[model samples]
Target: MSPNLFFQIKILANITELRSLIIVKQLLNSTFLYIGTFS
Candidate 1:
């Protein structure tokens, strides 16, 4: 494989990881809020 292709794939992987982290954080925040409201 070419260096350029590898670099692109690495970047894509990082972006995907970052997006999933953001989503998980949002979900956690919402869950905490719900618990706080009811308890």
Candidate 2:
């Protein structure tokens, strides 16, 4: 495979990882807020 293709794939993988991390962080924050308010 070409170097460009490898780099592109890596970039895409990083983006997907970052997206998931953001989603998980947001979920955790929301859960904490819910617990704080309701508990």
Candidate 3:
């Protein structure tokens, strides 16, 4: 494979990782908020 193609794959992978991190953070925040409200 070409170097350019490898770079593109790396960029996409990084973006996906970042997106998942953001999603997980949001879920954790919501969970804490819910628990706070209940308690």
Supply the global lDDT for candidate 2. Answer: 1.00
Position 8, candidate 2: lDDT: 100
TM-score to native of every candidate shown: 0.98, 0.94, 0.98
Q: Please, what are the lDDT tens digits per residue for candidate 1 over residues 1-39?
A: 999999999999999999999999999999999999999
Cα error, residue 1 of model 1, in Å, equals: 0.4
Candidate 1 off by > 4 Å = none
For each candidate, the alpha-carbon lDDT, in order, equals: 1.00, 1.00, 1.00
The full ranking of all candidates by TM-score, starting with the best, is: 1, 3, 2
**What lDDT is obtained when candidate 1 is compared to the true structure?**
1.00
lDDT of 3 by residue, 1-39 (tens): 999999999999999999999999999999999999999
Off by over 4 Å in 3: none
Model 2 is weakest, by summed lDDT over 10 consecutive residues, at 30-39
